[model samples]
Target chain A: MSKNYSDLNLIVRSLLPENQETPISFLPEDHLQTDLFFRRNHFTYPSLTNSSYWLPIVGAVHTPILFSFKDLVQMPSHTVKVVLECAGNKRNLFKPKVFGEQWEKGALSMGRWKGVSLKTLLNVTGLKHDATEVVAEGYDYGNRTDIDHTFSYMRSLPIEKALHPDTIIAYAYNDKPIPFKHGFPLRLIVPQWYAMASVKWIKQIRIINKKFHGPFQSIDYVYYPQKESDAGAYPVTYNRVNSIIQQPLNREVLDTGLHIIKGIAWTGKGTISKVELSVDHGETWIRAVIDRPYNANYEWINWSYEWEISKKGEYTLMAKATDSFNRTQPPEAMWNRKGYGYNAIDTVVIKIE
Target chain B: MSKNYSDLNLIVRSLLPENQETPISFLPEDHLQTDLFFRRNHFTYPSLTNSSYWLPIVGAVHTPILFSFKDLVQMPSHTVKVVLECAGNKRNLFKPKVFGEQWEKGALSMGRWKGVSLKTLLNVTGLKHDATEVVAEGYDYGNRTDIDHTFSYMRSLPIEKALHPDTIIAYAYNDKPIPFKHGFPLRLIVPQWYAMASVKWIKQIRIINKKFHGPFQSIDYVYYPQKESDAGAYPVTYNRVNSIIQQPLNREVLDTGLHIIKGIAWTGKGTISKVELSVDHGETWIRAVIDRPYNANYEWINWSYEWEISKKGEYTLMAKATDSFNRTQPPEAMWNRKGYGYNAIDTVVIKIE
Candidate 1:
C-alpha cells in the first residue's frame, strides 16, 4: 500500500515558539485550526474518506463489536483540555542522545479533546474477567528497522490505565473533526501517559489475558538504561514534573531593570504544587507566583517570577517544579537508551545589559 | 537507484556520552574503528566499491581536472584533531524549537582526520579570476520539500573559507579509511564551519564566479527567524563558542563531601579563553581550571571545577565559555527557523545528601 507520510515539516513550521507557553495563541476565533495542533504519528497517515467508519474490537472479548464512528459520537461525550506530549519529547537532551524522531520540546501540545471515556466504551464490549491488558492498533503499518516483521503501530496499557476515567476514545479535537494527521476518524487519548500510549487512527482494540508484546510496546518505546540490556528495560509511562520559560526568551537581552519572567509548569501524575525560579543560577531559588490554581489534572498552569536586574552581565535563569506528590523535576532524567521522558529542570540563559 | 540509509540508531548507540568528549572512547585497540565514529549524512550513503576513485574539479576552473584518489594521496598530507559539531547540535534547546533532526549534545565528536589541505588541492587547477564561491556536491541525492527539483546534496562556501589552511580533503579518520556511512572515498573537512559544510561522499567541487543558489545553500539550512519570513534568513556558518559538563551528570546525587565537576569547551572562531562554573545556579561564578593549554585551534580542551558540599539539597550547576576574541557564549544563540548554532551556557542539576 502506498502510504502518504504526514508533512512533518509543516507541523513544525506551524508550531508557536516553545516560549509562548500556549498553543491556543495560534487558534483562530472562527475555527479550531487543526493543523496548528502538534501531531506525532508512528506511521504514514491513512486515507479514510468513507461516510460510515467502524472501529473493530477483538481479543479476549466474548462479543467483538464493530462500532461505527457515528455510534461513538452518540455515546456520552466529555471534553478535556489535555496536554499531550510525545514520549520522545526532549529526547534530544539525553546525554548519549537516543534514537527515534529527535523531537525537541515542541513535541508537546495542549488541545481541547472531546470524546467518550474509554471506560464507557469498554462497558459496551464487556471485557472478559481474565483480561489483563488492552492492545490498541492503528491502521497504519510499516517496516521499522528495530523489528524483523512488518507490523501496524500498536501499543497496550494495563487494564487499570486503560480503564482510567480520563482515558478516552477521542472523536474531535478543538470542537472540530480530528484532523487526518492527528488520527482522523478516531484516536485513543491516554491522559496520564506520554502520547505513544494513545494510539492514533485506531482501528482495533484487543483485550488480552497476558501482557502485550507488540513491537512499539516492547522494543521501541522502552526505557533501557544500559543500552544493550533489555532485561532491565521497562515500558515508559507517565509524564514527569516539568516547566518551560515562556517569556524573556532564552537569549533575549533585557534592559537592566525590572522584568517578569513567565512560563508554564505541568505534570501528569499530580497537580503542580510549587514552581521555583533561580536567576542567580541555582544557589538561591525564589518561589514563583502560580498564575492559576490547578483546575485540571491534565492541563498546565502558568507561573511568573519577578526579577530586578541591577547589574550588566550575563545570567543563567532556571525553573524547577514539584508536583503534589513531592515529585519534583530532577536535575537530570535517568539516561535511557530511547531517551524517553526527559523532565529535567528547564534553564534559560538571559543577558541583562 | 538504490540508497543505503545510515543506521542512525546504531551510530547513536555507538557514541560515548558527550561528557566523554570523544567518540573513539568505545573503540577496540586493534583497528581504528571508523564505523564507531559519529556520522551525520544529509542523504542516503552512496556506495563506491570500485578500487579506483576520482574527484572531479569543475566550475570556474580554466583546467578542470578529474584527480584520482591515488594522485591526491601523493600530495603532502596533514592530520589534524578536529572537533566537529552539527550546526543543529543544540537546536532542540532553541526557544521556538526549529525543525530538522533534533540533535542533542551528542551531535558533536572529536576525530583525527588525515588528508591533504584543500588549498593545496585547489592549487593544481588554475582558478578563474572572477571566482567568488566554491560549491561542493556529494553523490547522494534526495527529494526535499523545500525545493522543487530532486537534487544532490550540495553546499557552497565563499572562496576565502574554501581556501583556509585548515580546510582539507579528508580520506581517513582516526588513521583508518573512512567508513561507508562516513563518505567512504573522500570528504571535505571544513574546520571552522559546522559539519554540514564538510560534505561527505564528495564527488565534485565547482568554483563558481558568484553566490551559489542550491537548496541547501539558500534555503534548507538557513536561519529564518520569526518563521514567517525568509528575508532575514542567512546560511548557517561557524561553530559558536560552547562547552559541556562531563562529570557529575545531570540530576546526579552526590555524597556529602568533595566532588570534581569536569567538562570540555571549544570554539570555531578562536581558542577557548576562559571557562567559568556556577555551582549555586548563577548567583556567583568561579573560574574553572583549564586542564590543557590551548594548543590547537580546532580541538576542545578539558576543564574542571572542585566543589565541597556539606548540606543536603538540590543544586543547579552551569558552565559558560569565552573565546580568545573576547567573545563569550551568549545566554542564547539568535533564534532562527532552522534552529542552528545554539551556544547557550550548559547547565546540570544535581542533588547532595
Candidate 2:
C-alpha cells in the first residue's frame, strides 16, 4: 500500500484481491482525498502504468480510437465529486446471509474525479446506431467460485448512462494521477450507479449492440428478487437512497449534553431531498439539516442533527433519507437473495451515562 | 369479532381469513388470557362446534383410532404455558421483501395451554415401526395463490419432535375450552417452534411412513436460505432466540426521568438465559433482569432494564436475548428467501424530551 493510501486507517477486508474500507467515522471530512479513499479490487493488482498507457475503444463503432492517457488528458477535462458505493457494501447486514465480499457499510468513497467525458469520447469514436451498451474491461483477471474460467473484471452500462455527461473516463483523482491501487492509468466512472459499473484499470472498451450478458452483467451483480427463480431478476444498477450515522459510532457512550449526530446520505435516482433522524424508534421523525451545497446526482449529502439532550440514558438513533423522487427508506430493507440495495433505516444504539 | 378477543385491541391483518394480531404492548400480563390471545388463520373459519368433536389418528399406525372431545378430556391431563409466534412475525422487516402475510412484530402471544399430550394419543394408536412423520391437518381449507387445489392447512413434525412430551393436542385455553376463534376443539401445540407447526382447528393426523410434503409443510413453512435454489434449505422448526422491548413503543416520547425498559425474550432450543439491553449502538451490553418465574421452555421470559435518565434527547433501546445454548440474537436476521425465523436484535428508538 502506498504511504498515502495506507495511512488513512482504511480497514483491509481481504488481501489477494485487495479490498479496503474507509474507516468512515475516523475521517472527519466532507469528501475523501485520493489517499484517504477506499480501494476495492477483484483480482491481483495489474502492472502499474504511466500516463502514456493507451486505451483502445473497439467494436461496433464507425472507427475505433486508441487514446493514450496523455491524449485523453489533452482533451477538455471534466471533474465530478461523485460517490461510488459497491453494490455489496452492506451485504453483511442482510439476513439469511448473502454471498460474496461481506462488506459492512464502507465500501464507498467520494472523490473529485477528473477525466474526459465519456460522451466526448463516444462522439470522437463515432459509435454505430445499433450500439446499446458500453462495456469496459479491467486489466485484473481471475477465476471466481461462480464461474469456471478466468475472466477479467468487467461491467457495462446502458447507452444513455454511458453517454450521460457525468460518465467519464477518469484519469485523475483529486487533480492528481489516479493511484495505482485504484486503476492506475484510466478508469471508467459511471455516476449514479454502484461502483461495479465504474470499471477500473481501463484496458479497453467495447460498444456493443446487445444487452451485454457477460458474467458481471448476467450472472453476478444481478438482483434476484425471490429465492426460487430468476424470471423477474434484473441487473443491479443505481444506488438506492441510503444514509448512515457516522457521528457517535454505534454504542458509543455519551454524557447528557449537546452532541451532533452527523452522517452522509445519497441516492442514484435523484438529489437527496432531506434526511430525518429518529432518536425515538421511528414514531416521530425530526428532519435533519442537510449541508445543501453538494446535493448533486451521484453525490452524497452531509446531514447533521444537533441533539441537545437533557436526559442521560440509552438512546437509539435511526437515520433515513428521502430523495427528490419522494422515496423514503423503508423500516426494513427490501429482501433480495443477493443482499443488494439495502436501504433500510439506519439504526444505532447509544448509551448516555 | 368476539368481545372477549376484540376488546384486547387486536389489529386486523385481514378479514376473510381472519388474521388478527395482539397489540402486544397493550397487555401487561406474563401470559395472555384466552380472551386476549392473538389469532392467525389461513382460511375461513371452519364450522364452529362444541365439545364432542372427534379427532382421528390414522395412517402408519397399528390401529387407526378416533377419539371424541370427551375421550380427550378424560385422558391424563397436561397443562403448559407456551408462546406461539408466527414464523412470519417479522416478515415485514426482511430485506428484498418476502411473500405471504405482511405481518409486523405482533403475531405472537402466550397462553396457558391445557390438553392431552400428543404422546398420550399416539401411544393409544401405537405408531408402526415405519412411521417417519406425523402430519396434522386442520379442518379449515382454502385455495391460495401458490396452489391450484383448495387444500386444508397441513403441516408435519418429524417423529422425534412429534413424540416430544411438550407437543400437545390442546383443547383448552387458560381453564376453559379453546376459544372458537382460535381452534375450538383441538389445536396442536408444537411448543418451541414457529406457530405454523402448531396447526390449529385440527381435524385429523396421519402417522406417515415417509416425509410429509403437504403444501404447508413443503411449500410454505420451509426455509429457503438463498434466492437461487433450495439446496440447503430446511423446514422451519424451532423459534430462534429473539427479544423485543414492549414498554417503550418505538418512537414513544417521554420526559427525562427514571423509566423502566420492559420486554419479553424467548428461544426454542433452551432457556432464555438472559436478555441484554443496548443503548449504545451495540458498544456495551447490560444484562437485563429476567423474571425467572416463567423461564420455561417454549415460554417467554419478561425482562426489564431500570434506566434512569438525567439528560434527555433521543435514546435507542435494543434488546437481545441469549439462550442457554450459548447462542445470542444476531444483529441481523438470517437471510431466508421465504422470510422465516427473523430473530435479529430488536431495536426501538425512544425520545427523551
Candidate 3:
C-alpha cells in the first residue's frame, strides 16, 4: 500500500488538507488508538522543522512569557478523557446542505489528553484584567478554496473557558507524547466544547481585549441563518448531545434472531443522561443499557440494547441521546448556514432474511 | 506545481475524483474554453487504454447494436449551446444543510456540444415500445464513501427525454473532440437538464422498462425531505432559474465611480426573459440589459447594469433571473435532503471607498 493510504479504515475527506474521518464502528471501548484517531487539518500539516519549539504568550497580558516544549511537559501534568468532535461532523446527514467538508458521523474521536492546565499558563503569564478572549494560533497556513486569502487556523476561547482548570495545553495523548497528526508539541484541549476549540499545533497564544475577528473566528464556524449578512450569527461552541449506532451497519443483512445493537453517546455541556433506541423509525423507543460508572463528564459513554426479532424484513433503527443539560438530539437538526452541530437522531436501516 | 496540478483558474474540490470548479468569473463571452470548464467526477477518471471504443446499446431494444466511437462521430451531427450545471451547485449557499458536495456557483459551465441526436441513435437501435427509461452507465466505477457497495456512475432518463431531438450523444465540446476529462470517447449531453442527466464516459446504454435504481439514481441525487424514509423523494432534473454575479466579487473594494455590474443567467425549461439587479439588498431593483440574441433556449445569457455609486460605503449587490416559464430565482432556496437545485438570489458584498 502507498504511504498516503491509511490502512486503519479511515475515510479521506480531502487529500490536500488531509482530513480523515475515524471509523467510529471500531471505537466501542477505550479511547481510540492514536493511529486510529481522526485527523482534521484546515491546511496541509504544519511543518515543525524548528530545532526547538517555543509557545509564545503575548497580547493583553501583564507579563507575557514564552514556554519551550520542555517547560510545558515539565510542568505538573494532568490527564482527562475528553471527546473532541469537529463542529461540522455529521454534516452530510443534515437536511438542507451547508457549505463545508461533507463530514460523516466519524469526524470525531476521544482521547486521554495529558498536559498542564491552560489556567496555569494564563496565571504564569499574568493575563491583564481587560483580556476578554485568549487566541491560540497554529503554525498551519494556506489558501482555503472557499475564500480569497491565505488563512492560519486560529480559534479563540472566552476568558472563563480559557481559565477553566480542565482546559489544558495538552502535549500528550493516551499516556504518550502526542503524535504529530494530533498536534505533537502542544495543543489545547477545551474539554466541554467542539474540537474546533482545541486548536492544534500551538505556535502562538494571544490574549485579546475585544472579540477575535479572525476568519476562523468571525467568518467560518459561526452559526447563522440563511441570510445575506451576519445579522444574527454566533460562534459555535459546545458539542450537541448525540448518539451513534455502531452495530448492524446500514443495510446489513442477517437471519432473524437476537442481536445486540451497540452504540456511543456524548454531550459537551454535561454527561449523557439517557440514550434510547427505536427500531420502528422513532414510533416506539427502548432505553439502551448505558455502561456502568457513567459519571464521565468529558468522556463519551457506550450503550447497548438487545433485540429479539422474528420478522423477516427490513427495519429502520434510530438512536437518540439526552444530556444532563436537558438537551436531546432532535429528530431533525435545526438548519444553519454552516452545517454545524448536527445532532439529529442517529439512524440506520437493515434487513433480516 | 505537479502533473496533478491544474494551472487554470479552477478550485479543486477533491483530488482523487478530480472535481474542479471553473473560474466562472472569467467566463463573460462565448462558451467557456474547454480547458477552463468545470469538472464534476463521482469517481476517478476511467482508464481508456482500449484500442477501439464501442458504445453498446442493449436491453429492451429490438435491434441492439454497438456503435464504435468513429461510427457515432461520422453520423449526421448537431450542435447546441447548453448550460450544464451540477445539481448541487450553490449548495453551500443554502439554508439548513444537506448532504453531498457543498459546491459553489462555479460548479457549472456552458459549451457548444456537437454530436448525433439521441433520437437518431435510438431509432437505429430500435428501442422497444415498452422501454421506460434509458440507463446510461459510465465507465467509471468506484466505492462511494456514503454507501456500502461499489457503484458505477449511472443515471436514467425517461424515454421521452431519451428520444428528444435535443438530447445528443455528444462527441465534441466547442467543435473539438471532447477532452479526456470531459469524457473523450462518448458522452450523453442531455440538454435542458442538470449535468447529472448528461452521463459522461459513456460505456453502455441500456433501455430499461422499469425505474432505474442505481445508487446515483435512487440514493445520491434524489431530493427528499429531512424525514427518515424516502417517502417523498424525487429525482432532481432541470437547472433552476439562477444567475451569477461575475463582477465586483464578494468583499471587493472599489472606487466611488460608475461601474458595469455584469452577470450571467440561465434556466432549464426556457430562455431567460428578465434579469434584475438589487444593490440595496433587494429593497429596490433595477432591470439589467440582457445581451442581444437572447433566444438561445439552452444557453445562459449575459446581462449587465451600469451602476453609478458616489457613496463611500459598503454595498450589497444581488442578482435574480427570471425564465420564460415564469420561474424566478427565489431569495431563499427551498431546502432539500441532497442540497440539489439551489436557485437562491445571488449576493455579493463590496466596499466603495
Best by lDDT: 3
lDDT of every predicted structure (CA atoms): 0.73, 0.80, 0.82
Which TM-score does chain B of candidate 1 obtain?
A: 0.89
Share of reference contacts found in each model: 0.00, 0.00, 0.00
Candidate of highest DockQ: 3
Which candidate achieves the best TM-score against the true structure? 3
Q: Name the candidate, 1 or 2, with the larger TM-score value.
A: 1
The CAPRI class of candidate 2 is incorrect
Show the colliding residue pairs in model 1: A280-B282, A280-B283, A281-B281, A281-B282, A282-B280, A282-B281, A283-B280, A332-B251, B224-B337
Q: Write down the RMSD of all candidates, one decimal each.
A: 16.5, 25.6, 9.8
Task: Report the Cα lDDT for residue A139, model 1.
Answer: 83
Q: Write the per-residue lDDT of candidate 1 for residues B1-353, one digit (tens) a residue.
A: 22111211122211111111112212222323344444565544555667878898988888899989998889899887787888877765777655455455657777778888888878889888998998889988865544446889898989998888778899988878876667768989898688889888888999999778888877767777767667777778888899888676565445677898888888988888899999888888999998664456888778888888788777889899999988787766788876788889898777675
Candidate 3: residue A177 lDDT (0-100): 81
Residues A246-328 of candidate 1 have per-residue lDDT tens digits of 66555544567689888878898888889999988888999999876446588877888788878877688888999999999
Cα deviation in Å at residue A191, candidate 3?
A: 1.7
Across B21-120, the per-residue lDDT of candidate 2 in tens digits comes to: 6656656656565545666777777875554678999999998999998899999988888888999888767876654555667888888889999999
RMSD (Cα, Å) of model 3: 9.8
